[model samples]
Target chain A: MITRVDHIGIACRDLAASIAFYERTYGFSVFHQEVNEQQGVKEAMLRINGTDDGGSTYLQLLEPLHAESPIAKFLERNGEGVHHVAFGTADVVAETEAITGTGVRALYEQPRHGTFGSSINFLHPKDCQGILTELVQSPVHE
Target chain B: MITRVDHIGIACRDLAASIAFYERTYGFSVFHQEVNEQQGVKEAMLRINGTDDGGSTYLQLLEPLHAESPIAKFLERNGEGVHHVAFGTADVVAETEAITGTGVRALYEQPRHGTFGSSINFLHPKDCQGILTELVQSPVHE
Candidate 1:
């Protein structure tokens, strides 16, 4: 079962610049920052207002560090913007099955390791009517 | 201060078909439906996991009812997909002012009426890195 919105991912060419824009303009505060060497990108998470439990959810901005990163490709094709919206789900595999059963293409046949230690899968935007949907299993903090 | 994510708006060609697809595929239920003639859209709100307290906001499918509707133009240009991600705000006017003062383009000079009796103002996707951002005021119950 899928639940509330987890976060909206935005891909940008310059992570620092975009973060400055969001923070200065929207009052969004940076929660954390990291560089994913495998994805070849640096990311910053921003906490927006309205979080009930210390703002457990936030938006992620990704800046590709290399030309071969998928984020780079997405930025090149679609430009800097929303990459995907992540939804917290109980069973990503089941949700993928459910969505794929409707003839929507699932980018991943099974859930893969997601950022912040979550299990996630991607559904192609073509099948999702142009909005890339990502299903993520929220990480349980010990 | 806006904190948590409120809801994501998806622009669909057919609201009924989209609603049926979401319900049948994802087990979401339609909680509310309304047509904002001024915005030129018939919107159907589907609750995720049947939460009705507005904690987990539903997916809003927008179907443009007129040729000149802004949604219709969006569809024609961008095709069917996620239109905007609305962040719930306690003071939309203040948020709008803050957002616009950043030198980013806002689609509306002032907050306009939105479906479900909420006030909303749109920030241009060009300014927001291709992701349309909407500042939505708290819902007014009838």
Candidate 2:
């Protein structure tokens, strides 16, 4: 069901500052950047190493666009830190159905738009041992 | 400095249960399991996607060996969830020196023995935007 460990999302107070820290400290370069009003997050995807393998992973830095955004609320409760771990999937709908069939809940009834035109749905953290998990089906997969 | 996102350390209450959950829910299988007394953790590394790429990622499920273990203390305070994010490096010593040179503190003055003969060191979370970061030099790299 899962293809790879897609990305780890990190919530930050400032997008540019966090980006600078990762780039300077770990030599990561931002591969893509976008703002999603629906999610209320300004995000940057940093490629970990220069690999372009089918399973290339990333560190996603997220800053809230508003106080009402989920990322903002997460920062308020947990401070700046990891927000979620996303797994790459070839078919998120099937994967969601298969997992939720086992009684675990999905955050959405249908897959939602994610970064880089990916389709994503989240698994409830309570059921995932306190770790919020996202299943992402990239545009290539679709 | 860093080669890849090596693994995400998830602090779990029970090693077997967590292993079963990941294997059953996400089709992940345990690739390696070890007990590290120095780290006070019984850990299982589940290979994500079975890619075997140079940058193959993993979900590291960690269970505390004793009540005084750092993982146990983390569970008592934060419950079961991600404990740290490890980045792969060819030379942990050089990576530690470079990162700490920027004023970020490494948890150990020297690299310590890690799972599977990897040398590892941790960075202070306070300086990493509240994310506990680990630098791992795998035996292959060493």
Judged by DockQ, which candidate is best?
A: 2
Pairs in clash, predicted candidate 1: A49-B2, A49-B3, A49-B4, A50-B2, A50-B3, A50-B4, A51-B3, A51-B4
Question: Tens-digit lDDT track for model 2 on B34-116?
Answer: 99999999999997743333555779999999999999999999999999999988889999999998889999998999878
Model 2 Cα lDDT, one tens digit per residue, A1-142: 7877889999999999999998878878899999988789999999774333365678999999999999999999999999999988788999999999887899999999999999999999999999999999888534
Tell me the deviation in Å of residue B44 in model 1: 1.4
Off by over 4 Å in 2: A49-53, A140-142, B49-55
Q: Give the candidate number with the greatest TM-score.
A: 2
Question: Alpha-carbon error at B57 in model 1, in Å?
Answer: 2.8
Interface C-alpha root-mean-square deviation of candidate 1: 4.2
Q: Quote the positional error of residue A45 for candidate 2 in Å.
A: 0.4
Model 1: fraction of native contacts: 0.56
lDDT of 2 at B113: 93
> Candidate 1 lDDT, tens digit per residue, A1-142?
6665667898999888998888877778898788878667899988653322222556989999899999999988878878887776767888888888878888876677777777889888776667788887766521
Candidate 1 residue-wise lDDT, B107-137, digit = tens: 8877899867888888888888777888788
Clash pairs, candidate 2, are none
